[model samples]
Target: MLLSSFVRKGLLFFLLTCLSIHISKAQFLLNDSISYQPKKLTTLGISAGAVYGVSMFALNEAWYKENKREEFHFFNDAAEWKQVDKAGHFYTAFYLSALSAQSINQCGVKAKKSALLGSLAGFVLISSIEIFDGYSEAYGASVSDLIANAGGSVFYWWQQNHWQELRLQPKFSFHRTPFAPLRPAVLGENIPTEILKDYNGQTYWLSADMDKFMRFPKWLNLAVGYGAHSMLYARDATNTANGYDPYRQYYLSVDFDLTAIETDSKFVRGLIKALSVIKLPAPALEMSKKGVKFHPLYF
Candidate 1:
């Protein structure tokens, strides 16, 4: 039922591609030499398609096939983990759309063309995964997931088309938790595995650049985050029977925009761009069913 790893890898690949494009473009601009070839654009499109096809096939065989079959159907999982998975879906869609658009733009595609195609690509990539889940007995196609995916892609497209920049970015962060050990079979058998499967340890955030709206530092951001805890089972009753109390966690924190740091080195810029996907450590105020608490440092 946990498919974060697949989506994470897809996002990582797109981020890397975007970083590479930025670095290469920076170098070209520095040299006062730049050119766009239709052949290169065509090749990039073909390669992207091949990658998507191969990834889908591999994921279907390695993960989805392990689950039992089910009648094609839709599921309502909007309330799962207080919608943490939904946030993750949105995060994935937003970043993938932005990165895809940047990658296409680098290939000499027109801004409008690249933005439209990239947004479509991002929406399709995330939505296609639902088809796999729809056939698996362990999970079903979720309309909530599709809605989140659309929200993310549309956010990116609209921002790029109007503002021409990302003033608000979706980010993710995680911290190891002891709760995973309580249910290894369901959570994970190892730390690496648990980090991906355990919703209790994962947090999804939206970091907004305050400078976009007011006089503020460009590198500083106000972030709102969502996470969960004590969710070893899908049902609260099951978790309660296991002596666990499930609760949703909400956070308000300060974040940094690594990409906003002034830098002339292309490599540094690329590295910053890649690192920007992560929510930086900072003090946070958390509100949950247990009430409010403060963290000196929250990931």
Candidate 2:
């Protein structure tokens, strides 16, 4: 568990770093951000249909185990399985069909036919899953999941038709921290020329370690992080004699976009894009700080 936590934290940190860069860069591309065009409607429909059909068969075994009964197979309980014990089986097909429709739409499925085909695909796919789950002892099918699937299909279509806004910033930001790590290598030359002359009394710019990661700004897949690091007193120079450095040498920084989407950038677009075959959900961004100041778009 401890190791897992460390790994999880490390992954989060890495992702945060990447998002910071992605968003900063996306801010620059001043074009119609939302691209809508469907492709491969039928292919998605067929594939989803077949997969869900097979899945129903597996669910029968799960359902049998869940009921504390001997494992049941479609062949073993064909008569009993025919009974509509599960309510969501139909809806499962619905959602799958919806998903398949969405995929086809994304893959260049056209309108009218595309919408029809997408809807058919969703119904068929989702219903097929329901059938599979009907037989599972561990997992049962319900109308609720199917209803939810329909709602989801509608939701996707609503967004597709009325995509209010899109702000994908797959950009990179750089906040070089020269003042950090003042501890020079031990047994080395005392205060190298570059260091002594540079950081002695100069007020160095303490920006984020922007280069450490990039950002993922596709649609609303906005991931951002303002480097929260600190500036510590060098061991050689804690405090000069008696007069305290008064500036409170403790180092801490917090910078990030304050927006409506900050709460779930990773949950929505980031996860969806990752699960998909999207190679460039977040294209590269132009990262150099533009003239425009950062402000909350929703606010």
Pairs that clash in candidate 1 = none
Cα lDDT tens digits, model 1, 1-299, are 55544344444455436434533432111111235668877877787777777777777777777788978988787766657777877887886777677667777777766777788888887788788778878778899989999999998888777766667788889998887788777667787767667788889888898998899987789999999888877667777898889998999999987756677886786677667888989999999999999999998
C-alpha lDDT of all candidate models, in order: 0.75, 0.32
Q: TM-score for every candidate vs. truth?
A: 0.86, 0.30
Candidate 1 matches the true fold with a TM-score of: 0.86
Overall local distance difference test of candidate 1: 0.75
Worst 10 residues of 1 by lDDT: 25-34
TM-score top scorer? 1
